[model samples]
Target: MKKLVLQFIYGVVVKAFLRIIVGVKFDNGKFLLNEKQFIIIANHNSHLDTMTIMASLPRQLIHKVRPVAAADHFGKTKFKEKLSNYFVNTLLIQRKRDKENPANDPIHKMVDALDKGFSLILFPEGTRGEPEVQQPLKPGVALVLLQRPEVKYVPAYMKGMGKAMPKEDSLIVPFNCQLVYGTPQIISHADVTPILEKMQHDFNALQEKLR
Candidate 1:
């Protein structure tokens, strides 16, 4: 039942809204349909970012893609939690960690999701920032990549989402948006610095492509 609902929502409703209503130009979107499992690292701007990415994915892969979202924000209320889980199938993680409980760590949870064969949509920037301005990516993404060195990581850049649905506003404005996907990379390096640098470089290059 859940799968059926997700298929309809993502395949019809979300896809129509993004493509017909909001107008998203997807670059290299075919690459996503061919992969079985992977990680999508994208810039954080508006709440629409996740939906845009989700809508771009092939309808068949809807059940396999899970966006990593903040537990505090998305799971704050019971209704919101149920709605997100039922519709978006988001993997909510605690932004604030408890040192005593290793099991509660966000990286561990993310790695676990990967181990289970679920592709993830990750916003490396911990939270939403100024429109079109990307903040420094947190180390958590590197940590997740380190644990799963074999998984392919795709760098994605979203343009005009901030103006379409800025962090401050609850209402969405109609605007043309662009989503660009870079070549996927498998980083097997042991050091996190080089991994992070590569991600940042790839993201910067993708952003430049849209400009």
Candidate 2:
């Protein structure tokens, strides 16, 4: 209840600042569903990728979406800290040379959320990418699916964002950008790799089409 009010207020502020300053735009947004706990996955291409995804979601569902971000990136800055806590609901995961198994830690919080039928937004690429090309996907999302096949899998592709607002650059490019949310899919344990692979291909194809 308290979270809902904060989401409403923060949603307006976040959306306003983004649309006005970053010039972000959302497209094909009706496909996002509010039913099941979702394992929303997408390609990683730009720094604004996180904000773009959040901005594209429906206001009511916005409070439920949490982005699994690299601890090394979003955790480094004071400004990003607040944004992550508020907007991203940032689940900081270790993406490093010698990382510990997340399953042994507070990751139960993620499992618990799914248990409670909460939705989440995450990147399969793990981190940012090279230019317009998406970064290679990690097996983490699928592993999450294997643990909870009951979860819905949504494939979203954000185009023009890499150019609209890039990493290490404060200047925003005033181009009409968009986010494409495809139909949600379920990844059963049987032959799951192909589904994830195809989804990655489909996501990249959609981004290219949007571009």
Number of backbone-clashing residue pairs for each candidate, in the order shown: 0, 0
**lDDT of model 1 at residue 51?**
89
Worst 10 residues of 2 by lDDT: 97-106
lDDT of 2 at 40: 73
Per-residue CA lDDT of model 2 for 91-150, tens digit only, reads: 665664332654533345456567765677778777667646777677667766777777
Off by over 4 Å in 2: 1-6, 28-30, 76-83, 96-109, 188-192
TM-score of 2: 0.81
CA lDDT scores, all candidates in order: 0.87, 0.69
Any runs in candidate 1 off by more than 4 Å, and if so which?
A: none
| CA shift of 149, model 1, Å | 0.3
Q: Estimate each model's TM-score.
A: 0.95, 0.81
